[model samples]
Target chain A: MANNKQYHVAVVGVTGAVGQKMLGMLEQIDFPVEKLYPLASKRSAGKTVTFKGESVEIIEATPDAFEGVDIALFSAGGSVSKQLAHEAVQRGAVVVDNTSAFRMDPEVPLVVPEVNPEDIQKHKGIIANPNCSTIQMVVALEPIRQKYGLNRVIVSTYQSVSGAGNDAVEELKDQSQALLNGEDPETNILPVKSEPNHYPIAFNALPQIDVFEDNHYTFEEMKMINETKKIMHDSELKVAATCVRLPFFYSHAESIYIEIDGDDISIEDLQNTLKDQPGVVLEDDINNQVYPTPLSAEGKTDVFVGRIRKDLDVANGFHFWVVSDNLLKGAAWNSVQIAQQLIQQPGGLK
Target chain B: MANNKQYHVAVVGVTGAVGQKMLGMLEQIDFPVEKLYPLASKRSAGKTVTFKGESVEIIEATPDAFEGVDIALFSAGGSVSKQLAHEAVQRGAVVVDNTSAFRMDPEVPLVVPEVNPEDIQKHKGIIANPNCSTIQMVVALEPIRQKYGLNRVIVSTYQSVSGAGNDAVEELKDQSQALLNGEDPETNILPVKSEPNHYPIAFNALPQIDVFEDNHYTFEEMKMINETKKIMHDSELKVAATCVRLPFFYSHAESIYIEIDGDDISIEDLQNTLKDQPGVVLEDDINNQVYPTPLSAEGKTDVFVGRIRKDLDVANGFHFWVVSDNLLKGAAWNSVQIAQQLIQQPGGLK
Candidate 1:
């Protein structure tokens, strides 16, 4: 059982939506683990989670909780990560954080395994996960960048309600039901949780996905803009984003307009390159109604790319639709992939 | 009662989605009438509708149904309109058709009351109501065009399922419930009812809104392209559309990009103009989360315009988002507004 001596991996905030998905992904990928610890807030301490066909009781997360843990996966809120993330790192555990608390830090590697796996080596004990919208987009664009150098990216996202958390999904459901029942709906948690005004997400589209930033872009939009450059390790890559929350419950979709440095590349050539890329699925047959939908990509880990066509007048511009499970590829699966990549690196595990 | 000796108006296909909205508009804005006839197919012939607090029986639409009618509003499917529209016109009724059946017909004047009310007089016998997407875009763009000539328009829509008809709404509802219940959902309509396959619209987005046409664009997309040109009465205008159906049930939202002939127009000037325009509400204050959303625009007749800004790196390009109830500004309210405009004109009455 020497091969089983991999690592004792602990999942912080195990009761939350993204944390649950991380556990499901861990089982799905069958990660090499010596032991698993499920930690949550004190209120959820005694709750049980099914991990790899075994029920594990959740423990209250604290700095002392990571005494012997080799890997700590953090999907808790940003405040929680800010509080305990350094504590976990101080105790000699490598932390893969799924919050924005450490993502922009100069020391933490904002990693998407496919796009910046090598960045993992430079992490100062804490590797940060890029925003969900940024994760799927970088996944689709990285291979393209490697093939044809990227110059600019303009993305408009159709994000799902689940990205706001489980409560937002329930709010959408309740509001839709209220509308159908010929009653007025009550909205308290969408378009931004901490914001004063709540817009109904049922049968509607909201242009602001997250709280507004001083630059006239929402925080969600800025994440895509800033995180893209950080993940690609190119501060000069021009990026803009318009993040929108639609009435979808799962999977985030984006319409991306990208300008490549090379002009002679036909759409067919780009399609051929994307078709062979790892963790990417091409669904771009426009004639036969073949394209990716958020519902179809709900439980899948692969980023689905389609609508690959040249822009009407721009010579080097290409437009495509990229969709992936924001909770999976955007969060849980990417963390697991990063862990696996860290294990596979030349310097063996501690 | 003697003052009731006004023109006799007939509403064909009165029981359908757009037809019902037309009826509501007729009631909401007192369209003068001596008598009103509600005509539908055999399936809805005997149904009773309350118009202006009076129960009006729906008559079966036939050639003789328009005998003494002065104005006819047709919103049935294309086949019904193609067959019955000519008959209504021959019977001295000025038919305002709301289907794609006559939108592209050279002899028909496609009208949006604000943009092309004068075009209503040019109708051979019938005026066409442009597609819902086109109606909203042109209404927002016409003022801009008047101030600075418009050269090109490229729009991508996040449309609602209700645009397909009442059945598509039912499919979305049923499929959502089925998916949430962990059951296989049924899909009998959508993307095109006559097409071979049906896809579940719950938690999904379909790129094709209507049947595919010879030009490789869906009929809905082509309808937007052709109808925009026709409604603007400028055949030389370059219009391109990508119409996508999201799971939204009410209002349609569009991201419109336009290139104007003038130079160096500031975003503030554009916002001020839209704020003063008729049937348009400006909601472009990004500092306070003041952007127009489909939920806020539902059941409203005004086009909610916001996110107005100059395109980056393009001199004459500007981008905006427009939202309005598809059933209102796009179809029913537009038809009724045209009728009111005609009534206000010199030769509008018999």
Candidate 2:
């Protein structure tokens, strides 16, 4: 049963935006699979999803669905993950939960494979995926943190609507078309779906990504703040984030300013360090107008980092713009990489 | 002619976006005008621009056009301002320039009436206007800086295409329309009109605004950094900025972080101080999801401040979002205000 020729994998929440992406990610990475089960809520259970050029009927994602599943990817919702992740773990499957349910839990490891693949080894049956905005940022900044000894981070995110969900993506397109036709755009899902009021994301920027916390930071902003500390294993690191939802449908961009512990690190020094990192693509040539836009980063797994320059006043401070596909590197590909790295380690399949 | 009632006024760059808004702002503020002269390039001249319910022909913006003008408001390009602003000034017209030409000139004052009405008195012949993005941020932070003793500032701007010019605005609309029709968006005037590369701004964010300077900061970003110090008269203050061109068409929004010298300043304290400021409207109620977006601040003359919260780690550090119509407060309305504020003062119109 251990390190078998091929493994049975079940995709929970197979009908969701990220869940649907997991199938393609697994195929893109060429994950060895003996059997694939697409699992969703009972309402969406009967639909078939194409995985590796074959239609696989989705089964009910109850506790019993985890039977014989060696790996389970959960993206249904927080409630679904909270209810059924333990059941999958009980059935001898490792769970990669793509929800906020267990992200801050002490028992779970929030894994971004590029930054902390080693943390996956300590996962007690469940590994949490960090938020989309947090994933791309850590991938870019972790190298800098390691080489330069990071001191502080202040990030302002320009996130895409897909980070909200598929419905929000549709809302953006519909709204754009409506506005183009001189009609009022319908607002049903943006900013937050569960929130009472919704705003149009077409040709607009919403400062609130998720709901606002008591401290006035949005839930998305706090996730970037708290998760960076936990993932970087630096409790004393000062971090602040202002997460905003922009009109794009693919990648998330960040304007990140950081203060480093190292002295006199030049832009070339930073670029040379970042270029050596495997997951980061350095696109920082200002003379040629070389930089990454969300459109340029669409559907790409690698994080694009550019606009590297020193702060005008603060000698130790540096700033850059980072962008990546929120769905790919931010969600499904990260989850797939975690699962892939999980099995590569010794005694990885418990 | 000094303090003459209903003085003759000239609108430079009358066919441009900010120029057109200048006409409306002059009317909205009800400035007493004996006659209006709309000036544009020779090609765009001869077109009638309606003002005060009558057609006003746009005269060619020549040196002789300033003959009888008491006050000339320039929004024409920088070269035009450079060539003609002084010509107008020699003809005894006080120039309120909206270009980057004279902003950094020590003799000419960079005035945001809300922040530095007194600086206008130092103007030799022309009073320079700050950049649209800088004008809005300084307006929001000046009151805070005055009350709390400011220390550091970091701003990331989400600017509209209209800040580039009317062609950029049409580029966005045409690109959005093309994108909605499932066609590739045309790119001609975005990021910078004169730059070699053009990227689609439809559903995309471009980190570059204006051309990149020698230090890798965009001209827009350097303007924010340099102008903030000059306007606040605090060269020792730490300021950094990242100016981005978003898909929005009207208002420019900024995510600003500041560290003040005062201790234990609460969000309520900041809000109380900001609300009392005349030009900044406080719209920060997190519980009800009340904050300003680009859409909400469109067509408004006031700078909107919201999402006020203190940083989690830095006791003296705080963050807020500011938005204002880039064409109005950023350019036209501000210029009109300077002119009105000028005429109200004795010995103002020389």
Candidate 3:
């Protein structure tokens, strides 16, 4: 075994949004790292990112990049992760993947550190980060799930265009300007870019996110459905999602209706559970008009949960609103938490 | 009985969003208007609006201005409508109020022409246009309700800023530009302007649309809950809403979960019913990548319905996505449809 020394960390896809967030979080948390490796595509190889007041040059992400790394954080495209994640795993690096490539794999533990930190111990070499939408949701619901067993979850997401990537953010900007100037707006990246027709996202809501699946659900919707089950490890948990992209640039808001197993769990009890839970920010104050909003939740790492109320007529039903930065808790912060756990948990790096 | 040859139309609050939409709809539908009376507050009384290529001067909306007018479309603030709607009714003008003033009044008929045009005949001098969100939902659901009795409706809305009125649209634009240019964004018009301490909406989602009620539901949500029952004329219908405003300029998207009375009603049946219904554009082709989006629904008059699918395990339960321009279907078009019904239906005119 190695002596008590800081681990050498490598961040793959350091140029992307989630990757950029991963770098920032690493600095914020001051993850004990003797050496830092920032890896991106060949195009971004020469770019420099500051870590611990030291400028580090981004290297081309390749199989050899993880040669001596003890921990690797992956947030690149799924294809890139699929190609290099296993290679890094084989090279004795614990890979915390932030892509869908390994999330559904039985062998890889899909984790929200706050919700299922125990699952992290079962990982062989690679751990998968749950979907951004799924991460915040389970973080908010798991406390309630633990207190009052969850039965069904119906969530509809008001996602920002930023979740689609940085380009969609630009598209929203250009399109909004076009709409304001009375010019014909252009759409090349919304509701699925490869899809034949692109709709103006400037003033519209698109019911479809990601591409269509064999089932009626969009890929984005299915991600929420499947990833929730995997993260919660409850195949029997009834989950349905409608993922819609709004024109906002950051953060995702979810209107979630959840049915619990217990017969008489009051809103007060649920609120108490959330208020005590880690990584959860309770923002439900009706009198002062304080509640979780996507804008207010933006740039915040904690999952903001509010609007906790029992259903009007249903006994075991409750509805709450959840908001978190899709870039943070939804993606980057989650990946970093997994890495932080890797350093602290027993046998995490062995 | 007044002659059908020409109806003297008075447009109340002629400078506002829904008010402007009402005027445009009157022109688009070409209501047989002998004289166009544009009415607003004293501040806008002398302002002129183009009606059929002719500029008509705005008049101070008072009891006297409504005299001899056959139909008056009121889209002013709720308080203004509450104060003057009866006066307009007393002046012999049939009032089609687009505010919440008389919507819950049992004496006034709450009408969505496509859903319940017959209700217009029961109007006691004033007919209430349903809430924009409620208007679109009922328009889409009425067909399904006709086929399969609706037991419960759970809707979480992704509403546009324009639904708050013209000021919100300007605020969104100005705030977004301010954010982009690294300037301090102002927030004086959203989430109830009367509330102290405003939040930015440029890249955010606000869960509260109106003032919070004691029940923890926003006034906007209550409007939806109450309006759905009133417009559907089913006081016992279980309807719940979580109204949210995204930074979109127009259109509202709703993720609606509904339980039908019959177990035999399949997703296909619901799709077919909506596809064939008037004022509904069914866009649910998931396999070929077709579905309704708020962006595509923007500027369109029809309610775009898609993502129709039966709940995975629950029988008689279905989920669908509905999108429509709040400015149009939610406000402008519904008012026009009311005007058209008043002209077309036998004894629709008071």
Candidate 4:
């Protein structure tokens, strides 16, 4: 493929939150798209989404929808990806999946460009994007791990409602307004939409993000724990996570504790390593009270790292507060970055 | 000094949030109060606080305010407590101080009645109340520590605005409404009111609760770490905390991880130990989506425990989600419980 040649790009689940974000990010980043296919479920098929100031019709996602597509970004739920991703791959298109369907698949490489750009080259016609929480954590930890060598990690996340999807975002708004008006907020989706019980996410924190696994950990937490290990490629590293949902509309903030293998690493060493890392911005200054909050990191593509400090008792332990736009760096922008990596390979994507 | 005898009680900082809660708890519990003297700073001296459907005129807090008082409940700032607690104690009043002034004092015993009631007997004139975050955590961990023998602990707190005082609570409400209305929320009191820079806590999470100490841990986080050891009487316990202030108004929730000493401790064993403990209500039914949220635990005195699970990798490690009314069990109610224990002593309070 030549640099001047354009590619036919397809955005699957184009009407969903991250799907919509993928479309906007493609336009913002000026991806070389000769033709755009906005694909969705049959219910949302006829809907039109604006791209480059022109309306693009959403077509029903089917196996044949990938006919001439060069890259397909899948942001639909896991089942949709499970059903359509391979078909897209078989049609000679590289699929960058945003769902968790193939994240743990040994055959598919899970890639965060900042942390593991080379993993994109190992994909077998499909690449898996990590979870929103896991993406930001690994991005912040990767530079430190490369410099200091990570031994263990313990993370507690303060996630926003947007990570659940567009409906959860709407539910958060409705519930917040209803509560402000002193009425009971209707809850149809939250914690887990498919689960039997739903909790209100307005002005409250929900401990369970996805449904529980047999081991009593929510699948969301398990995703963070397992995906961090897979992305970092450190199977022996100890990682633990507690993922909670808060009422914010964008960005997820994490309180992370990491133990470095070396005992001589200072806060300055960690800050210096993260300052030069790609897609990461260090915003730590205790005297100025500067640290990243969810709202502060909204609409940003960079993972903001701050509140870096050494643990009082643990000699090699350090703590950090990492925040990033869950939709951008966590999902849409990351998928787009991987697609760009595929495009920028010498002789282009094979 | 007899059990049936009514005692004179002085409620210091009567105009503040926790002080007002103290007055309500005293009335709700029907403590044997012969006369109630509501004492505040000179600025709030004329304000009236309601008690048992009667208005009590607020008097200026002076050393003479404790002339006839058997117990003085102090919820004012630490400076006020440092300046007045000793004076009140010198006037023959048993002071149960709620500020952080004397919590770490070698002579002062920090008491949580449910966890360490015997420590109340050793108070040298003043019994210090532990920080709100520490009180709830120690309450939830005491039963497990006693039965299983604890070795290490780590906690991340989701604290509410009320823990910062009443003005901070009002700021949260104002900031939330302002943000909802598409206006920039004014930040006069949040993260730290006295600090030079303030961050909005409406839809954001602030990692710093109090000012940063020399060790880079915020005063609030340090309090949780230091005070927990003092209350538990275990100097060898490894405790680390990351305290974050959320947008809620009443309850503080904590995600706590602990490593028990015994290898055979199951989730059932931890649950059984906490189920029978006083002031702890176990709400750990995952099937029913039963877990304690700040909204669900508001105005409740008991510490609600849920989401009990064993760590996936660590054999002896377990995790818990604990919630309690920060102003109630964390401050006012804990102080009242200490006073109750003081009265229940065989010879009454010395």
Candidate 5:
């Protein structure tokens, strides 16, 4: 691949929230795309999605859909990725999967380009993207980890409905409108779509994110717990998570507690380190009543951190808040950044 | 007083949300009230409240309004309590102050009947009610602390706007409806009412509960930390808090992490102890997807605990979620219960 040559890019689930954001991120980053394949289920094939003011026809995703496709961004579902990811690879396309398909697979590199760019070079045919909550948290914590060593992490998340899908977003909007009209808000898709129970997210908080595993941790919690260890490349790092779905439309907020290995690191020390990070913006100023909320972080690409303080008892313990748009930085922008970093490698993506 | 004797009660701030709930709680508990005096500010003095189907006239609260009153339940702002609480006590009525004006005072005893009923006997004139978020958490954690000694605590709260006041609840409702109608929601009462800045709480989460202190911890967060230590009677306990206000209407939910002293406590051991707690209901069955949400715990009086699991690492660490109505168990019901317990003392009101 030459630097001047353009690439053919395919976006699976082109009409979904993350997929639509992926198209916007590609254009905003000015990625040179020679062709765009808007891929979706057979039911949606005839429809079209606009890319850079040009309408691209949707293609029904199948084994043959990956022909001549240089890169495929998959966010349809875990089942969609598990089904056609290998098919895309067999047809000479690299899959940047945004599901839980191969995140823990040793052969597949799970990358957050800011934290572990070197790991991207080891991907065989597919690269895994971390969960939305995990992606923002690690980006904020990585700066601290590089300056001081990290010992333990415990996070409680306030997530938005968009992370579930575009349908979940509509469900929240409909529910809000219904409740505002003094009617009952319908619960069709939330907590987990496939699960038996559906809880309303209008003016409510659902503690369960994904289905519960044998250990009683929701799959979403386990993803944060497991993915943080993998992406930081320190399996010995201690992580615990409590993921809750709030009524917000976009951006996920987390209250995180981390114990660093620095002996006498002050709040100023931690602030300076995070302020210098590339993709992170430090919004901390308690005297000025400054901190990031879900509403303030919407449509932003960089991870926003504020509300930093040291634990009253432990000298090394610190607490902070992190927020980022789940659609862009958590899913679409993260996937695009990985692709951008991969192409910039010497000799290009091998 | 004899066992058959009835008491005279004055409901201060009678026009406020908690004051109305306090009247209901007194009736629900069938307290032996000889007379009910509904007291409020000059603006709300003409308003009337329903007690046992009777329209009780609201009296303007003043230093002299406590005459002939045996018990006073105060829920107005801290300034109101500071101005008139001693005046009420000087008028010979015992005050159960709900504001933070007297919680940390050495002479005033902070009591959560389930956690520290014994502290009620140490009060000179005023019995202080703990913060709403702290009350529910202490009830759930007290049982665990008894069976498996405790070491440290870290909490992130999803508090309701109702905890602020009736006006904040109206702000959330109006803002939510406005946004549903495709208009920008108004922001004037959230994050903090008196603070210079107000953030929208509809369809979003606000990280600041009350005003920030000099230490960068919000007043609500500091209340949780200091009040827990005072109520638990353990100054050496390590506690940290991050309080966040959400768009919910009635209940406050807390994600709490505690490091206990038990050597080999299994999940069931912790569950059994919490189930047997006097004022707590255990709702921790992940297989059936049974956990308490704000919507489910709206009108309930008991603290609902669920999602109990041992930390993946740290054999002595455990985490759980607790929810209870901010008005009922958090304020009104707790105050009424304390008054009931105070009368049950050996010689009645000392």
Candidate 6:
């Protein structure tokens, strides 16, 4: 029942945060790979990355690097992905992009395998991975939406620093130590690195995740709002998000409120639906004081869903606490899962 | 003309977190305090607190401690307030309780000075200070409500550890230091100290702010919901809250979404209303990356409001980022303001 043929895979941006996670996940999941190419920028080309206890030298991520690659995982920044993804596709390799460049493109399918695996069939050689915050939320809400139908969603996120890349993670650690030593935090590379006026993210929460648009919503918030509507295939669905970067280093936690289409939805109903879902784990046990936290879900692949409760005032409203490793389910693991799905599909890469 | 007459003031729980803040605020505002009594638990009775460069001895909080005391600010705890508030009231002290002991008592007016200072005139001996999260939110929203008429409120709080008192703050600091040193965190106080199974709050976000009730909502969430309705004097207002505890020490941040009663309400309208409102500062210049964070609002008296925007889908929906020092505007300063109101009233303590 299983295809045992191994294919050549290329992991782009191999020196960065999510790219490193992609290499680790590919080995952890034991993906069928005959050859591996670890590609990064010219500055990091000579670096070596470990895969399956074997050291692989990083190569430059150029257009010719995608030749003979069956699946290419791109976790570089948006510009790098935009410059090279089409080249990979033109070389007959399926591209799973982990950036915002192609996510809202109708030609590319934004997919969470558990929620919309069927959407991949519509892809034109490139599949877009949803934002880390968006991926965990859709995974937790899809079962509920399927059973009761969702009308509205309002989410507040406590995102970690790793989503910004490895440099931000180092900044958080250094700032935490400095603050604890009663020293002023050295500030740079947070709440949008390119923007002026950087604020320290250690022991603090920055309300802005990305640059603000004309509408006052940050780009990260818009990604959550827009990508959610596209991935769920419901443009009429009401979605709003407030994305904040916290001091945590790995996982992102969200406080989600959703209104079901009809009345009489119970906590048990939501719990049962989540428990039966493929990539969701239910951890809600209020009596034992059980719920999901970012630190607890740091290295986990599945989205941890907990804190399920019916709204006190709204009859159809329900609340949930969702948590997952941003690097895993939010980026690398989701891209690898798409690659897994691509290999599993009949003639998926032809 | 302002009254020059002084009054005898009592600061209950003087050795505790909010109690110390109350003492500082009383002096900072240059209140006409002829005499001051600092009361605390018996264990902390011998502690000395400084006021206006003078040291005041901490006395044990007892029924007789309020004798001839014109105004008593109670912040010790709920049980302590419940036991001694009436005793102090019987002794002719106008009690401004900071705990949830009598907030929803119907007879006890829950007052935010900027929002409903007039409600203090209706107080029968005791005026309850609303919950910290509720106080800042209502202060920011009251102006909008007065101008546009509010129909619904949905808030998610990123509350700090100091709101749980000094022990929780110490836990956060200790856990943070330990985690940074690569040691396992020793958890004792958090997400309700009375509840079993404490989770580390150093680098994590806990969804539970207080222990859960039968309906699966935490007591803290219910407090926000019920207190908002009562404080606004609008029972029909649809309000929901999901309160989470973060690792920050002083200020609490809220992500609030509100539906106005009428359509065509613009962000400019909301900004103009907030700009003119008392005790509320509008810091919403996204072009310069101006927004309030908990660190920036620490020790501030005003409720900092920003991130104001109109919802993309809901015609009347508006969103805001509200931040304030939970101990100041939320607890201590609000109580002191109520005391100030009491002093200005004719025959206030008679």
Off by over 4 Å in 3: A1-4, B1-4
Measured over all alpha carbons after superposition, the RMSD of each candidate to the real structure, in angstroms, is 3.0, 1.5, 2.2, 1.4, 1.2, 1.1
Task: Write down the DockQ of candidate 3.
Answer: 0.65
lDDT of 1 by residue, A1-350 (tens): 22444788889989888999999988887888778889899999988999988999999998898888888899989998999988988998889999999999998899998887889999888999999999999999998999899997777788899998999988988887786677888989988888878888877788887777664567887788888898998988877677789888989998787889777888888889899888899998767778898988999999999877676556787778899999999999999888777776676543
List, for all models, the DockQ compared with the true complex: 0.41, 0.86, 0.65, 0.69, 0.81, 0.82
TM-scores of all models?
Answer: 0.92, 0.99, 0.96, 0.98, 0.99, 0.99
Q: Is the docking of candidate 3 incorrect, acceptable, medium or high quality?
A: medium
Q: lDDT tens string, model 6, A1-350?
A: 16788988999999999999998899988998899999999999888988898998999999999999989999999999999999999998889999998999989999999999998888898899999999999999999899899999999899999999999999998998898889999999998899998998988889999899999999999999999999999999999999999988889999998999878877888898889778899999988988889999988899999989887778999888899999999999999999888878886454
Classified by CAPRI criteria, candidate 2 counts as: high
* Residue-wise C-alpha lDDT for candidate 5, range A302-322, written one tens digit per residue: 999999988988888999999
Query: What would the per-residue lDDT of candidate 2 be over residues B1-350, giving only the tens digit for each residue?
Result: 24558978999999999899999999997788898989999998878999989998889999999999999999998999999999999999999999999999999999999999999988889999999999999999999988999999999999998998889989988998888789999899998989999999999999999999989999989999999999999999899999999998889999999999876889999999999798999999999989999999999999999999999999999999999999999999999999999988885565
**What is the clash tally of candidate 3?**
5
lDDT string for model 3 (B66-106, tens) is 88898998888899888998898888888888888888889
Best by DockQ: 2
lDDT of 1 by residue, B1-350 (tens): 22333778898888878999998998898778778999999898888998899999999999999999989999988898999999998999888889889888888888998897888888788888988988988989989999989998777789998899999988988887776667998999987787876888877778778876644456787788778877787888877676778987888998777889877898887887788989889989987779888778889999989877675546787778899999999999999988777666775443
Which pairs in model 3 have colliding backbones? A132-A330, A204-B294, A204-B295, A205-B294, A205-B295
Error of 4 at B264 (Å): 2.6
Error of 2 at B193 (Å): 0.8
Segments in model 6 whose C-alpha atoms lie over 4 Å from true places: none
For model 2, the superposed segments whose C-alpha errors exceed 4 Å read A1-4, B1-4
Residue B161, candidate 5: alpha-carbon lDDT: 94
